[model samples]
Target: MYRFLITTSKGLEQLLQQEIQHLLPEIETRNRPGQVVFEAELADAYRLCLWSRLANRVLLQLRSGKGETGDELYDLANKVNWSSHFSADQSFSIDFVGTSRAINNTQFGAMKIKDAIVDHFKDLFDTRPNVEKQFPDLKFHGRLNKEGFGIYLDLSGGSLHQRRYRERAGRAPIKENLAFAVLMRSGWVDAIRNGDESSAEIPVFDPMCGSGTILIEAAQYAAKIAPGLHRHQWGFSHWKGHDIPLWFSLLDEAKVGQITPSMRFLGTDIDAHVIEIAKDNANIADVGDFIQFEVADATQQPNTFEKAGYIVSNVPYGERLGELTELLPMFKSWGGHLKQAFPEWHLSLLTSDRDMLRQLRLMAGKEYQFINGNIECQLVNFHLDEKNCHIADKEQDNHSDFANRLRKNISKLKKWLKTANTDCYRVYDADLPEYNVAIDVYGDWVVVQEYAAPKNIPKHKTISRLQDILIAIPDIMQIEPSQLVLKTRQVQKGKAQYQKLDKSSDELIVHENGAKFAVNLHDYLDTGLFLDHRDVRQKVRQMSKDKRVLNLFAYTGSVSVFAALGGAKSVTTVDMSNTYLNWAKRNLALNGIKGAYQYPLVRKDCLTWIRECEQQFDLIFVDPPSFSNSKNMQGSWDVQRDHAGFLRLVRMRLAPGGTIIFSNNLRQFKLDPDLQDSLGLRITDISAESIPFDFKRNQKIHHCWVMQDDA
Candidate 1:
């Protein structure tokens, strides 16, 4: 029997060992973090490489010895006859790992091994083999660590994970072997063949299937198809010691072993473009007829199968705070849908965030830890029985506490709302420390903003609190679930503030102090109208009667819409993004205001446009972002660093004695004294005046100033 070593991912060593034991039962095996060593015959090695799904590489042991210096490593490598493995015409490459005291550089250690092989061949046959780094005929692997040195011939050409079927992959695609491990740990194979003939046809579904990796793997497993059979070449195919006839016989057996099983594999994704890519990959794997692809959202998965089977998915892990905010509510809604529609189906979710998994409220039966490309992750298996489907009273207690806080805050803000004659306002802003979310009212609609949780708090606990908040908002606010909008509040910098979180084009007309504007609660992190700027928009209306007005850095042009309605002689709105420019025009048309030159919307960088403008305005609204590095802009913009220069440009076009209303949401802002001295302008702080009564608790939400040239 010959000794062979198999390598896999760090946490999958045990599973690989079990797989090997099943294929070759009499083989002696030893396993570690990423490698499994075993004693088997050459035929068994060939069989293992052909059928093993969880292995990354298979290497045949050639030599092992202790070596501290480069010369000693060369001596260990030279002990093997160099000409037996491959001829002088064949090309080869060396892959070196680990470092020792003497072999500080891996490249230097590899060079020593190469020299020894070439010298041995040159002295014997008067010629040496060529070294091809990209696609070599023979690949050598060397390891040098604290234990000692090992030299082996890689029997598996490249990484076995490259199944050669996926011509392309989607963003953050999980490796094929990793997907196999998930299926094994989740009992997918056992569930399909549980002695009941009816179970053999149980359906498998992946809602967030990206490039259909899991679906292809499941189809292959159910149909009894070997993964390596799709590849055209392998490391052993060109080796001199390879038994060509024996390999073909095994290949023919694997091909004949593939059976047409009665299994339904379905995959769905939100992106239609990616669904086509997944279909192409499935066809290449020869499982196209077994699997079906469609475009569907995870929150509202289609119940296509009559009987309950399995729902396995690699859900999104929000690496950014904004993404976390968006995914939390989606997970909660998906959980509710599964409990209602597919009560008997089991779920196996893989994600980096355990809290996200807990949002489903289903008790996980078993959990396995894995490392997916440096990110630690968990695969949680849930048997969705009646016992786990219902929410326990203890979970309801958290929701009750949040509702009580919301009710008390609404009672306190009720009188102020009536006095101001407003239907939209803020009801809750972290009144209780444990429930950290901001609640706002837009008539019958409510928008909830979750503040970023502290790093020290356990992520699962934070997610639990968010789920509780979502459950309480509709009940306490006496509104339907569709009216509640949830978002995560983060300190956005650069163009991230304008990034679209969703593609819903739904818009609503909301009133603020007798002026009507459009508000889209679903499409963006911030609603089209800033509720804190309610009083500021009113101020713009009061100051813009029949005056030539210019709105700079106008986002969505809510203030510009107000200025036009207030009888401004001319309104010039300037912004960079065409999306916002078109939105501003729609807002204008919605209010029955229309004109070409009378109310023109310019799609240009406000900072650059201001320098080129010669026309004067009686009133200018300047609300620049706190920080912006948009690629369309000339240079980076920081409100604090570039405010003085930006204001100087605005002053040149300010019809003499024109008023500039400068506002931003930077909480810790202090106007530069040098700017005030250089421009000879009189400045008044109207930050307190701009805030509506609902925003009294957080007075520093925005900073506003009235600047006038005192020349």
Candidate 2:
């Protein structure tokens, strides 16, 4: 029997473990912060790698992570029968992560084990094995922390966070794992499966389920479906030790447990466009019947939910979110009406600002305070009691309490923004009267949308006051503050542009992750920068130094910039559009970098460039659009369809010792076996993990590796 460890980032460990165990019930399952250890056949590893969604890597637990020093790491790795895993002629790569003091540099530590494996092969076979950085047939994993390190072969060869489901996204949308964490924290899983909560007898709901992550996760969890069952590989299958029949038997067992569930879980967002998106997501998840969503305000529809249920929402908070002065009073009225309307339904509202918490006078239950990504929010839950109606008589006092809380939160954000050095692109209710949400800008991005309450007075209309006073101040000050373009139930979302008095100067870059990044504070839906891929850039920094790095289909040169920063010998960034190539130069120059350090940003088509270029590269980062076309690169470019061709181009240009990190947003990808069969270059799926924690939404991202070898 072999032990397979399905690993995931923290928070979603339980959900993934539950799903894995449910699939292989006979396996001995043990859960940890980042992994789930189970005893299973090699075939089970193959099945899990292809199908598991939450696992970052499916590894064969060769060593129980008990080693401390780097030498001990090598000794432990060398202990593995090298011949049992890879042939003397074969190659491999080791990925180091979460190491402790014993292993300081991940790359340095990973190399030690790689050396050991090679030495083991040399000592036994009288010849050394090769180290393939790009796509090794076997991936050895070293996960170390305060405890020790776990040495194993990365069966999935990729992280499993990328489930590939989301087709589009909105600004600052919550991530899938965190969304799953939220649902898990809300006890929605148990409530849905049991048809009621331990404390309340009502249904669980997301009044503002923006991406349908909450609903989809709930359905997927309650049903005993393995998150990976829908995907193509189970990493274990790739290992020599994997047993095919055992893997299929596990799949068969999981399939038998599938049942159409009966539950009344629902979601509603005020935006109709998002409602359409939610429906699309529901269809893709195949849980359309299990969930229902529509356009309704969070406060408006709780009255419709006859049965008492949990009402949870990630509501508006910050200046980019728009002025909450009007919304604040609305919340008071909503809570009061909630008492008169649905006396028993519990309301749990999450907000970044503390003011929203006080405004939501949920008197009964205690609050669960935790950080959601970076936004610190409070999940205020309240159980309803009929007698609390007059208890609502403290309504006047509640208004004063809101005023006090509002002042504290406003001051807190004002200071937070200044220290964080962020920019402001969101000015809510700029056209409305008596609304005040003045946002400041820094780092050319909207990092803080400060909320300050407009002074109360028996004065002109609120919208008029906003246009004259709020907008006028910014206009008079010569600061161009763009109107907030958020999805709301209110009349219109406004046109997608900067609504300043004068034309503003803002440089926006749309990241492949679909994030709108900007260089200046101007009018834009967002400033395009994917901060989450910071680690990917970190990877490039280490690899590109003193080496020729190629960035294929490069978008604004994010990876290129990092590579240059890492002291790359020379860089050639390719793209079809001359416009983006120019922008890439500007982005690089903006960071005070200029020179042939990165030679000739090319405007040639990538497919053609790869075919024509006679040079080889030491490192390459390929992130192609899911679909696009140009004159030189005409017709459709589907990553799933064209990945093989792209890989061929990469393999052709890659240096003997080079590595290429190829990424795409295509949720499902099948390796073109013909490329491996016909071309003889090795390849593996490394996509599941390419999606960062912030960018994750099961199946939205896919990754792979292409490697060339020599005898």
Q: Which ten residues in a row have the lowest lDDT in candidate 1?
A: 391-400
Q: Write the per-residue lDDT of candidate 2 for residues 1-711, one digit (tens) a residue.
A: 787777776656777787677556777788987668878776666666645555677777777557778888888787778687667776677778766566768887888888888788778878987778886667788777777767887777656655556666444466555556565556554565555343333466777788676677666655655556655643444567666677778778778877765446688887888878878877776677778888887666646554766666666665433454335545655667677777766666666665554545657466555455566666666766776554643323324332333344445455544543223322222222234333333332233222333446533433333322332333222333343222222211222121231245545443232122334333333233434344466677877779989998886677787787788899888887665677678877766667854566888878777888899888888877666644456565667788877777778887887777776645465556687665454555554554443233333435545454432
**Model 1 / residue 263 / CA error / Å:** 8.7
Candidate 2 versus truth, CA RMSD in Å, comes to 24.4
RMSD of 1: 6.3
lDDT of each: 0.85, 0.61
C-alpha lDDT of residue 140 in model 2 = 81
Write down the TM-score for model 1.
0.72
Off by over 4 Å in 1: 67-80, 99-128, 164-174, 188-225, 252-347, 372-375, 384-386, 389-428, 439-448, 470-487, 492-529, 545-689, 693-697, 703-711
